[model samples]
Target chain A: MNDAQAPIVPAVEVLAFDIFGTVVDWHGSIVRELGRRYPQVDGDAFALAWRAGYKPAMVRVMSGELGWTLIDDLHRMILDAILPQFGLERLGEEERRELNRVWHRLDPWPDAVAGLQRLKRKYLLCTLSNGNLGLLTRMAKRAGLPWDCVLSAEVFRAYKPDPATYLGVARVFDVPPDRVMLVAAHHDDLAAARACGLRTAYVVRPLEFGPAHPKDVAPQAGNDLHSRDLLHLADLLDC
Target chain B: MNDAQAPIVPAVEVLAFDIFGTVVDWHGSIVRELGRRYPQVDGDAFALAWRAGYKPAMVRVMSGELGWTLIDDLHRMILDAILPQFGLERLGEEERRELNRVWHRLDPWPDAVAGLQRLKRKYLLCTLSNGNLGLLTRMAKRAGLPWDCVLSAEVFRAYKPDPATYLGVARVFDVPPDRVMLVAAHHDDLAAARACGLRTAYVVRPLEFGPAHPKDVAPQAGNDLHSRDLLHLADLLDC
Candidate 1:
C-alpha cells in the first residue's frame, strides 16, 4: 500500500500486462491524433465516445450476439457508429481504415518503456490484453516496448475477465498461476486475474480516461503490490 | 537459385519464421549440453535419437491418438523413452525436466540476431513455428532473438504442414497470404506455406543435423528466394 509497508516480492517468473490503458495511453493518443487529423472535431468527446463502445462491443461477442470478432473489427464497428455523431461519416474508406489502426500506433506512457526494459532483465514479460495479437505486436513495434512475448485475447479466443485469459499465461509458461503476475491499471482486470490465482500488481494510471475524467488511483484490497506507474513497479519488484 | 539469378523479392508485409532448425541449432545445442552433462554418454547419438522422436510424437497428437500436447511435453515423452537406451534412466525428475527444457535454451545461429534486427526494420517479424508458445517464447528470450510475436501450433491447435498453421499467420496480421512470407530451412515447411498461398524463403541450415549429417542446402523449385543463411536472406531482401 505504501513504500514503508511494501509486501515481499513474490517469485513471479512472468509479468503479464494489460495493454490499452495500462501500457498505452489510448485516450490521450486517440484525442491527439483525432485533433491533428480533424481540427473541427471535438477530439476529447470523440475519443471518449469511441472507447465508450469498447466494453459493450466485447460483451456482444462474449454473449454470442456477435460471432468471434477481433478488437480491430470491434473498433471499426464502434468507429462507424460514432462517425456520424462526430460529423465524420463522410470520411473515405482508406481514411477510416487508417484511423482504426490508430489503436495499433498508440503511444506508451512516459515511464513505460524504461520500466519495461528494467523489468525485462529479470523476468519474462508478456501482454495478456484483450487487444488482438496484431494490434499489440504493431503497438509494441511502434512504441519500442520490449516485450519478450506478445500475447492477446486473440490467442486464447476469449477476452479479459475470462479465467481462460489469465490462466492462459500460466499455461503458456508451464508455471502455476501464482507464478505469473498480472500488471494492470484496472482493478477489474486484476481482480479477474486474482480470481484465477495470479499475483496482481496495480499500476496507477490516473489520466487513463484523459484529464476531464480522472481515475481513482487508490490501492485496492486484493492486489499484491501497488505503484505510481511502471517505473515504480520495476523498483518495487526490485528490477 | 543463386545470387546471380536471385528471384525478385515478393512484396511481403510480415516475415514469419520457422524456429527449431532454421533459426536455432537444436541439434548442436543439445549435443553440446548433453556432452557437458553426461560425459560417459554418446551425446551425438542421444541428440539425434531425441530429435527423431519429435515427428512421431506430433503425429500421435495430430492423429488424436493422444490429446493435444505441447512440445515441452512431447520432448519429455521422448526423453523418458530414450533415457533407458542411453543409460540415463537414473536421471531424477528435476534433472529430466531441466533436460527437456534444453529445447528452450537452444543457441541461435550466429547471424540470426543481427539479420533479424535488420529485417525487423523493414517488416513485421514473427515466429510461425510448430513449437509450442512456451518453448518458442523461452527460446527467443534466452537466445536474444527479437521476435515481434511468438506464434505456435498451440495457438492454432494444429501443427506444421497444417493449412491452419500457415494461414493463421496471415490471419493474425490481416494480410493476404501472399503478403506473408514463410522463411524456413525445411523444404516441406516452405512447400506447405506455399500451398497456402504464402510466399516462401528457403534459408539453408546445412549444419542443422550436425556436420556428420549435413543437409543438402539446394534451392528447390517453388521457393521465391533462397540463401545460404539468414544474413544472406537479409541481404537478398535489401534489409
Candidate 2:
C-alpha cells in the first residue's frame, strides 16, 4: 500500500509484534511435535484445536471471571483437556509438562530473523505477545530472535486488545502512542492498536492455520502497511 | 585473582553489571558536560556532588520515607536542589529536565561494547542498575552495549542493595541465585547481592572518580572474581 493511502500517522519508532502466529509458526511446530509424540493422532487437527482454546482461556482471565493466569499455565490447561480427546495417554507428568513447553521452542519463519534484524537497525523491536516473560525469553534465545526487549502481557497483567498492553509499550519507551506501531497477523489486533492512536502493520500468515484451514483474505484499511511477511513489512517501512 | 583463591560459588551463568561507575564512566561524562555548559563552575566538584545525591535519593524511596520515584525523577529533584548551590542562574523547567536526562546519554567505557559482545556469546548478560527502563534502553542503543536484556531495580520497584532487586534477576531468568552474578565496582552493591545468594564479580574502576578523587583500592572477600576491567573479566570468564 502507498504511504499516502495508508493511515496517516507519525513515523513509527517502536514495532511490537504478536508472537505465536505472526513471528513463529505455532501450528506447524505443534503439528510436527504431535506427529512425533502421538503417531495415531491427527496431528493437524490437534494443533488447530489446541490454538482454538487459546483465546477463550485468555478471555476468562482478562474479564476477571478467572484469576490472573500466565500463558504458560493456560497452555498446560489446554494440553491436558486435548490429550484425552486425541487418544493420547501414558505420558508422565514431567514429560507432559515438558511437552506443553514446546510452545517455548517454536521455530521462527524463514524471513523472521532477517526481517527483525533489518527493522531493529532502524526501529526499536519487541514482542507484545500474550506469552509469559519466561517463555518469551527462552524462545528468543532458542530461536535466535534478536529483540531490543521482550515485552509481554505478563508484564502489563493484561492481554492484547486491552488498551493497557498497547499503551504499556509507549510508557516503557517513554514515547508517544503515534510513534509506536503494533505488527500482527490478526486484523483485530491491529485494529485495537489503531484505535489506541498507535500505528499498525498487518502481516499475512496464510499457513498459520495449516493447509486445510483458509486464512483471512479480506482487505483492511486500519493497517498502516499490509504485507505477506515480516521481510515485506520491513521493505514497506523502509527499514 | 586466581580462580582457586576465589570464593566458592556456582560458576556464574549470567553477569549483571552496575552501569554508572562499572560499565560507563558517569563522572567523566557529567564533569565533561559540566565544564562545557558552565565554564565558571567547579566541574569535578559538581559531578561528585550530583552523584552523591543518587544514593540518598534512592534510600528515601527504598525506605518508604518518600513515594516510589524513578532514577530520572530523582535526578531531576537533585538537580533542582543543587543548581543554586553552584551559583547558577535559574534555567527554564524544560532545560533543567533536559539537563537531568543527560544521564540517559552517558557514554560507555572504551572496553564496554567489545567486552559485552564477547561475554554475551558465553553468558546471559544484562544490566542490573538503579537506572529506570527508559534510561537503560536509551543508553544501550546510544552506547551499543550489547545486553540480552536491560533489567533494573525499576522492575522490582526497589533500588539496589535491596534483596528484592538482587533476587529479581534470578526470578526473571528462571535461574538459581548462585548462577546469577552481580558485577559492580562498589563493595556495598556487591555485598548485597552476595547476601541474597548471588555470585559477585568486582571490576575495579579506579578512574570512576576524577584523578583528584580516590576510590577504594582494597579488595574484599565474598567476591567470586576480581578484574581490572570488563575485558579482563571476559578473560577470567574464558569468554
Candidate 3:
C-alpha cells in the first residue's frame, strides 16, 4: 500500500452513522411511498427531485439565508415545490403533511439492524444525521435502529458537511474527534468528517439509489476502512 | 373531589422523565462511588453537599451569573469546592475528573428499566433532566434505560422548573403540551410542568435519599397520577 493510503486506524470509542442513505434505504422507501400516493406521476423522478432539493434547501440554512429549519420542514418545502410540477398538487394539506412523514418510516437496509447490534457491543452507536430529532426519533421507533443517542442537525441547528454536525457528535459524548469515527456511505460525508479530525469508515450502499442505480461502490481516497455494507464494515472492524 | 383536586388527564403521546432523584438514585450512587475513592470522608455528607450545590450552580446559568454550563461542569465545580472541606483534595486532577463521571454511571432504580420498557410499548419515552446530554447518554447505556430520545436542560440552555424545559419536549415532537406527560418524583418539578399545561405523573423513589431519609411519598395537590414507583405508573398508564 502507498503511504497516502496507509489506513489511519485508532482505538475508536464512538461510531456515528449517517442515517438516511447509509443505514436506511431512503430511495427505496421514498419511491415506494410516493408511488402509493401519486400513481399518475413517475415515482422515481418524484423521489429523486424530493431528495435533490434537500442539500440546496439545507444550504440556505448553512449560508444563513434561512433560519435553522428542521429537515422535516425542509422535506416538506421540497415536496410542496415539486408536487405542482409533477401534476400531483391535488393532494390536500393534510395528505401532503402525512406524506412528508415518509422520511420518518424509511425501512432500514436488511443488514443494518444486525450489523448495528454487533458494532454496538464494541462501541457507542449514535445517529449523526441531517434528519431532525423528530424524524430520527420516529424512524428509530419504526425501524428499531437501536441508537444509543439519536442526534441530528436539529440539535446543533446545522446540517451535514458543516463542521458543527461532525464535531457535534464528539462534543455530545465528550470524546476527542479521533476517537469518534464517522461510518457513512458517501465519500463527501466521510471527507467532511475527516476534515473535522474524525476517523472515517466508508460503507458502500450500492442500492442506496435503488437496484437500477448501483453507484458509489468503489473506495475513495482517505477513508480508513472501505467495505461492501455495514455488516462488512463491522467484520472489518472486528466487531 | 374539589376543583383543585380534579383530575386533568389528556390523551398523552409522550412521557418525559426526570432522571436524578426520579429515575436514578443519584445520592446512593454518589455516596457509593465517593466511598470507594475517599474512604476517610463521610460519603453521605459529601454526596449531600455536592448535590446541594447543583441547583445553585444551575441558578448561576439561569440568572446569567454564569453562561450556559453543562451539569457535568457544574458537578465538577461543586466537587472542587467541597473536596477540601471533606479533606479529599489530595486526589489528583485525573482521578477527580474520572470520579466526576460517577454521575454518568449512576444506578437506575430497580424498577426503572422494566417500567420504562413497559411505558415504551405505549408512549414515546424520553429523559428531561438537568443532566447534560453526555451524562444522560452514558447513564442510559450503563443502566439499560430505553429512552426514545435523551433530552436535557443543556438542549434548551435552561434548567428544570423553567417553562422552557417542559415545553421543549412538546416542541421536539411537535405535540401539544397536553399530549406530553412529565414523569418526575418532585412536586416542584411536576408543578412547573402542570403550569405549562403538561400532564404529570409522580413516581415515588422511597430510598432516593437513602434509608434514613424516607421522604415525599404522599400524593401532591395537582399531579394527574401518583404511584409508588415507575412500575406502578406503568400500571396506571396501562402500558
Question: Highest DockQ among the candidates is held by which one?
Answer: 1
Give the number of the best model, judged by TM-score: 1
Instruction: Give one digit per residue, the lDDT tens place, for model 2 in B123-208.
Output: 88889999987788888888888777778887778898889889988887767999999999999999999999999889898889
| Tens-place lDDT digits, model 1, residues B182-223 | 999999999999999999999989989998999899889999
Summarize candidate 2's per-residue lDDT along A1-239 as a digit string, tens digits.
Answer: 23443345447789999999899999999888877877788989889888989999999999899899988889988888888887766677997888988998899989999999988888988899999877887788788888887788877889998999999899888889999989899999999998888888888888889888879756698677787788888777766
Model 2's CAPRI class is: medium
- Model 1 chain A: worst 10 consecutive residues (lDDT sum): A1-10
Each prediction's Cα lDDT score? 0.91, 0.85, 0.87
Give me the runs in candidate 3 sitting further than 4 Å from their true place: A1-8, B1-10
True contacts kept of each: 0.74, 0.39, 0.71
Q: State the displacement of the C-alpha of residue B236, model 3, in Å, after optimal TM-score superposition.
A: 0.5
Cα deviation of B70 in candidate 3 (Å)? 0.7
Error of 2 at B72 (Å): 1.3
The DockQ ranking, best first, is 1, 3, 2
- CA RMSD per model (angstroms): 1.9, 2.6, 3.2
DockQ of each: 0.84, 0.55, 0.78
Candidate 3, residue B4: lDDT: 28
Model 1 CA lDDT for position A25: 97
